[model samples]
Target: MSVPVNGGDLVVSRLSSAAPSAPTAIALHGITGNGWAWLPVAAGLFGRMSLWAPDLRGRAASRLVGPPYGLGTHADDVIALMDHLELERAVLIGHSMGAWVGSLVAARHPDRVSSLVLVDGGLGTAMPSWVDPDLFMYAVLGPAIQRLGMTFPSPADYLAYWAFHPGLGPTLAGPTGHLVRHYLTRDLVQERGGWRSSCVLDAVRADGSALLDDEEVLTSPQASIGHGIPVSLLWAPRGALNQPMGLYGGAWPPWRPLPEGITAERVPDANHYTVIFDPPAVRQVVSRLLAAAAR
Candidate 1:
């Protein structure tokens, strides 16, 4: 289900087994991901909290929504979703780009965010100004950027493309196969001759540009924490390709560390994408939210 937002309906997946007043958690997915990406976390927390995962504008079901897309717009959209739900305050859980969005929300709408859980994202290191944004994105995101421009004859073709995806495909062979397939295909829209990914390239570019220089949102939380809002970060040990090293390397331009007062933890044996679905990773996320709710 989805609710009306600034530009269009934000598709939301609701998972609830508790009372309506149970501590509510609003989830935000990574840059290329949609609401359904948080299904595992919601499932893990079933019967405990009412979860709402929304597809931010220009991704998945919200692809048609026009731009003005960036971290600020995304933060506003999240607040709008909270308004639609009539929620005064809720825990905000974000993964990757979603984590960045969560930080902005916590900074701008502190009253509406009770706590923050950032999974492998909110603190993505910024690139130097001399580095070309497109080139940097290409180097970091690699084929993920290229796939957004390609087209496929059918959902099967798209699935085939991902058949060898280093982190996602091999993991799809188990009980979670069906769920994985749904996650991959959910954002696809059939076009005139074929199907293309629902993620908007222009929006993605705009977001990447914003992320390159947006330090305030990621760091401002240190000040915001003084207001009694708690923030936690759970990062994977590897990159998107499941590399041994994490995204932020120890190079000259090292990834900026989490600001003071923000708790941080690492998910061992997990990469950028796999962390959300990893069993231990999911447990950590579930435990954090439940503990926050208990307080």
Candidate 2:
């Protein structure tokens, strides 16, 4: 269902179960992702907790919601979503850029966030100074960012386009094919020429810049040991393109090490996108969130 918020109506997917008093988990998708991207998580947590996944402000059905979009706005949008849901507090599960947004929300609206489950994001992805920012983003994100400008004649066409992605393509023919297909088809809508991705390029660029600019939130005293809210990280062992290397070269960030109290786990044999969709990774994520809820 679409609910009106600051910029426009935010599209949300509600996945509920029979569990009484089940905790509500608000899911934030990555930069080019939308509500449906969390389908695997919803399935993984079936009958355990309810999930509310939103399209943010500039992706998929929420594409019409224009800027002043950035990390701050995304966090406010999430808080607005919580208010609409009448949720006093909920677990915030974020992936990639969503993890960054979730961190800000926890910092800005402490009472509303019970805990944080950051999946392959929030701690900050590597951004080398010698490499051009835009080029680097494109290189890391690949088809996720590239498909925004292209058009496809059909959903199959769109899926076919994604078939070339190094990390995504090899898995499409495996047991996880259906999950991969769902990800490719989620935000596609018919255009005058053909079908086009609903992701907003400008909003993505803004959020990307915000991720690079914001370091205070990651290392601030309030977000670390000083804060009461518990934070945990779930990361993929490999890089975005399914490379042998991890995001931080299998090391921690130099700008700020993970705080004393926070716990982190690396999901082996997974990459940026698969960390959310792969069955083993999804199970790990659900287990962690459920564990956090128990706390």
Candidate 3:
């Protein structure tokens, strides 16, 4: 369903079991990902929680969403979506960029977000002040951001690209291949006589810049997050592209002066991409959602 927000309509996918009383949760995807990225999470939470996954602002079906694009606007969009659904409050399950967005919502509009589950993201990386925004995005996102500008000849070619991705390869070749393919196909668009990623670079730049420059995004979750809200940080040891060190390396709290009132855990063997799709990792996420709901 599409609900018009500030700039354009947000396309949200509602997935649930037959039970109408199931707890509801919002699943937020990564920087260039679409709502389908949460399909695996929905499956894992099939009978327990209903999921509302939106093709956040400027990607996939919602790519036409115009300016006022940044994590702050994305937070507003999340609230708008909650209002559109007539939901008073919902748990937020976010990955990568989505995690950061969820953090903002939980901090700024705490009454609207009951709990926050951040997967491999949301925690701001302490980059040097002098580092350029463009370079920071490239350096931080690494191989995952390279496909935004490249054109693909066909859907099969795009599948091939994902098939070889170090972090995503096992996911595409594993039991969740169909779901993975569906998610990837939704991110493709035909234009300029060839197919390319639907993620907008301008939106990416704005969001990335905010991660570095904006105080709202730069603040830790413990600073402004509402009291009694459960914040869970699930980190993958490997990087997004399956590198040895991930965003937080192999440690859960990889920095000094740890934030209080948050639960942190590591999903072993899953990289950033696989953390949502892999069975073990999905179980980890599901368990957290269930815990949040029971709170």
Candidate 4:
């Protein structure tokens, strides 16, 4: 179910087992993603624990708000939702940009976090100087436009458009494609004889600026391991960003080296986007996180 929080909306979905005593886990998706992104992992952990996944502000079902869309603001939204639910602590699982927001929350409000699992993100790396902000905006916003492209004459037309995205895992081409089609058809609204994406494009543009501003958030010292938070970083071995680390001599954003107490694991044969979608690898990372939190 979805819940409203301060400043914007928070899309919350829960999965729990027959037993009521299970621990609770909260999953946060990357940019341009929604709660459904964690559905596969949540399914695997079903009955083992109760899972809550939220589409961060401006993405998916979450409400879009004003700009200066920094990590701190997103972190604040998560905190407010947790407070509303009366959850004192949760094992925070975040992917891509979500991982960075999760880190900020853990740092600023350590009391609210029981543990943290950063999925293929939060490693320190510098922003690419060459990519112009406008160009970056187009590339990042492309997926959303494609998804909400048009009020198709029919739903099949919409489904066909979604099939072309490379980010959806290879295995998802079959069943998941149908699932996405259903979501779009149901979520979109017909206006002026064409379907408009539920999301506000202007909000996306503002949020995009914050996300691509790697220098501000990525270079911040607060994101460093020195904050003394219990953290685990699951990195994708084949990630595009990871490849550059080897070539660039490890100079990256979040500009701090791995902390002494953190556990950093490498997921083999996975890239930035695939690490979250691949079942086996995701399960392994989640299981390891559960084990670590138990300690």
Q: Estimate each model's TM-score.
A: 0.92, 0.92, 0.95, 0.77
- Superposed model 3: Cα runs more than 4 Å off: 224-226, 252-257
Clashing pairs in 3: none
**lDDT (10s digit) by residue, model 2, range 207-267:** 8876665565455324733568888888787777888666644544423466677788878
Tens digit per residue, CA lDDT, model 1, 1-295: 7777767777777855568767999999887878888777777888889999888889888897767788888888888888888999999988888888888888888888889888877775556888777787777766677789899999998988877777666656755566667778987988899998899887887777877877876464664676678888777777777666666542323265657777777676777777877667778878887886766
Which of candidates 2 and 3 is the stronger one according to TM-score? Answer: 3
CA lDDT of each candidate? 0.78, 0.80, 0.84, 0.61
Please give the RMSD to the true structure for each candidate, in Å: 2.5, 2.4, 1.6, 4.5
Residue 121 accuracy (lDDT) in model 1: 76
Q: Pick the candidate with the highest lDDT.
A: 3
- Number of colliding residue pairs in each model: 0, 0, 0, 8
Lowest-scoring 10 consecutive residues by lDDT in candidate 3?
250-259
- Scored by lDDT, model 4 comes in at 0.61
Candidate 1 deviant stretches above 4 angstroms: 248-256
Of the two candidates 3 and 4, the one with more favorable TM-score, higher being better, is: 3
TM-score of candidate 1 to 2 decimals: 0.92
Residue pairs clashing in model 4 are 124-252, 124-253, 125-252, 125-253, 126-252, 126-253, 151-195, 218-254
- What tens digits encode model 4's per-residue C-alpha lDDT throughout 1-295? 5566666556776744425555677777765566676666765677777777776676556645434355667778788778877888877888876777777778777777777888866555554767565466545435544454456655565555555545443534643344344444544555677655555555555545555555655533244345555688777654333243321123332234665667877666565655666666767776866674584
Residue 259 accuracy (lDDT) in model 3 = 67
Residue-level lDDT for 59 in candidate 1: 88
Q: Order the candidate numbers by TM-score, best to worst.
A: 3, 1, 2, 4
